[model samples]
Target: MGIENILSVAPDLVDEVARLKSIEECKILKEKIFMNQLTKAEQEVFALAIDGHSVSEIQGIPHKEEFTIKNQKRSILKKLNTPSMTEAVQQFQNLHQEPSQKLIRTS
Candidate 1:
């Protein structure tokens, strides 16, 4: 994706935040955001990546260490099929921002 696409999505995210409807909806979004794209650990790294974290900084996310974090980063990029950290972040954002992908909770 290009910078233009990223900018276009920012407004949509803002709309989403401003329009919190229900906890069920939130849960659905989380389920969909992760889906098959990442494991919980990789999802954590993706969050840190979005926050502009360094490899060392990502490693130090409370319970995580350098080796595990580094490994997760590589895994996330591979799953995202992105060649760089920046591209991974962008793809992550794109995947999560779309409400159409929301997952249904089953009993």
Candidate 2:
């Protein structure tokens, strides 16, 4: 049986499964970040972007010129192999979501 089927039969194990899944996702994200070899600035821009910050908002917080921030965002997208910021953010969110949350999304 699938994990979802098993989890459905035993709701009490849901929290433990979600917690372990979260830990595994964190490790996966860390590995991907490291493998991408993003520079510090690129990493910072990426984090801000995924956190829902617009370029203008990021500029004010990072004290960077808009042009520079835009460039870094572009670099981040390229490194992540995402076509756009929206896609990158979606992928990031999917990676961090709990198993139950993912099921809810599909439904």
Candidate 3:
């Protein structure tokens, strides 16, 4: 069946699907931003970090020296304007989150 047919049968499902698609699109855009802003090595380091890998674990990879990985992580933080890796990960997570899902802080 076509989307129109599906929408007619379940409007709420259509909305939810659209919302999910939008979230995916936003994530893609954010990823593209990272690609544009970071070098290939930095991207690799950042990806490992995002996957919960420690610097030592990243350094354990073949041909990936400890100093190189640490430098790449520092570059990532500088490029992202984040003070630490944890905050950089949080920023990435926030960028991937849907608008409605983000918490609204108030005084």
Pull out the clashing pairs in model 2.
none
Residue 107 local lDDT, model 3: 22
lDDT of 3 by residue, 1-107 (tens): 99888768797777677776766676787668766788988888888888998777888989888888888888888999999888887887777664633333212
Instruction: Quickly count the clashes in candidate 3.
Output: 0
- On the 0 to 100 scale, the lDDT of residue 71 in model 3 is 88
Candidate 1: tens digits of C-alpha lDDT, residues 10-93: 998776655554434765665575545789878778777888887777777787777888888889878878888888777656
Q: lDDT: which is higher, 2 or 3?
A: 3
Q: Tell me, by lDDT, which candidate is best.
A: 3
Q: How close is candidate 1 to the true structure, as a TM-score?
A: 0.54
**Evaluated with TM-score, which candidate comes out highest?**
3
- lDDT scores of the candidates, listed in order: 0.72, 0.72, 0.78
How well does candidate 1 score on lDDT at residue 27? 53
TM-scores of all candidate predictions against the true structure: 0.54, 0.55, 0.69
**Clash count for each candidate, listed in order shown:** 0, 0, 0
Error of 2 at 40 (Å): 1.2
